[model samples]
Target: MSKPNGQEANHSRQPLLEGRSVSKYFGGLAAVHEVDFAVYPGEIVGLVGPNGSGKTTLFDCLSRVQDIDNGQVLFKGVDITRKKPHQVAHLGLARTFQVIRVYRKMTVLENMLISRQWRGETLWKMLKPSHKDTEQRARELIDFLTINHLTNEKAGNLSGGQRRLLEIGMSLMPNPDLILLDEATSGVNPTLIETIKDRIRALNKDQGISFLMIEHNIQFISDMCSRVYVLNYGQKLAEGTPDEIKANEEVIEAYFGT
Candidate 1:
């Protein structure tokens, strides 16, 4: 597959998301220590590191699920270091957890329909039946993700990859400017991994949505991201184009050489 746009072009655009000295602490230890990164508009950036390298902790800080002990996060040029999770979501940011968070008892369509429930609509409206327009939008997204046939299937019954796709669709319901995908390809069969990849490319290329995904699948990151960032021991280990990152000796020793 062809690579994403040149780094020169991305450098000219304001980052859709930026982290300045981002940090998180647990007692005496820092889970994420003063890491800085950026994802420009319409770009697919990869975040990769060994397990327990503070990647998800950084995601938690940026997504505002966890309070940072220090530093700031900005999205679309607006400071969001103190914003609530719902507030960030309202700002066109959405995310998937490393552990999938789909509503197991709900059908695929139901999950998608209610994904936007946290958008500050009236309590009564949320409690009532989903509107026709909302349902139609859900159907269209289902088709886009190529899971239309599973619309009525229970989320619990779906395979690992399908559940991941549902979670992604749930994220897309709000028409986000960026999505933080944590471990999107983990435990997924190879076939569905490709499917997930195609959907992400379609979302980025056709709709102009940006992505910052955490992945252990190096090949997936190599194929999808124009730029990649590496974290190790709660700090920025490396940042560059995929080829440059692959050639970094420090990154290889800390991450890939294991």
Candidate 2:
């Protein structure tokens, strides 16, 4: 593996996830074409592209939501290009979708508890007093997300922005090393967008979690991402710091026609 950039690779100092020359197709349409991407143990990488530029498709391929026609994906230095979604999650990789996903009928705490169940705790213990440790852990996570006040509220009752925050919080239940977020604040009211962004920043700073996000909001990318990659017509058009990306003529043209 080639060395990461000049900076110290941080806590674990490892590439939590990597994609090499990855390509994907859907009935002859190449959504992702020979793209290389990586996320280290403590960093925020943004993926940006226009409507048909293949950002989300590449995300799906990275998260194992779809199989790639060619190329390799590595997690913790192991090839997981062929692993199932559940298998990938077990390896400490998790993803949040473009659309919020929660058990609408369940309370916020219950929704998170359901995800905790898959983290190796026994099903029978979920209700027994023996599950105190498990429930306590769940409470801690809810508190971390600052949603503990809504623990008993039904997930369906959350505002769009709040649901987005909860979805990210739930993804953390398994304590993943890398989190793939597809438009974490899409469809949210502007007032709550900054709150969500702040939480993400805090997690990355405090826990050293790696993030790979696909988003259309230019301000979001400019404000939050340390590095940004722009794709156009299924290929990378530019990759650099947010300032460099903002100044790139190619990226400017891709998002807003000349």
What C-alpha lDDT do the candidate models reach, one value each? 0.89, 0.82
Number of residue pairs clashing in candidate 2, backbone atoms closer than 3 angstroms, sequence gap of 3 or more or interchain: 0
Q: How many clashing residue pairs are found in candidate 1?
A: 0
Worst 10 residues of 1 by lDDT: 1-10
Error of 1 at 5 (Å): 6.4
- In candidate 1, the residue pairs with backbone N, CA or C atoms under 3 Å apart (3 or more residues apart, or in different chains) clash, namely none
Compare the candidates by TM-score and give the number of the best one. Answer: 1
Question: 62 in model 1: Cα distance from truth in Å?
Answer: 1.3
* Ten residues in sequence with the least summed lDDT for candidate 2: 1-10
Candidate 2 clashing pairs, residues 3+ apart or interchain: none
Off by over 4 Å in 1: 5-9, 127-130, 256-258
Q: On residues 1-258, what C-alpha lDDT tens digit does candidate 2 reach at each position?
A: 212222224545657788899999888888899998777777788999899889888878877889988999999999998987777888888888887889999999888877765455556767788567657877887887778888999999998888888888888988888888999879889977988887887777778777888998878887777788899989988999888998999989998899
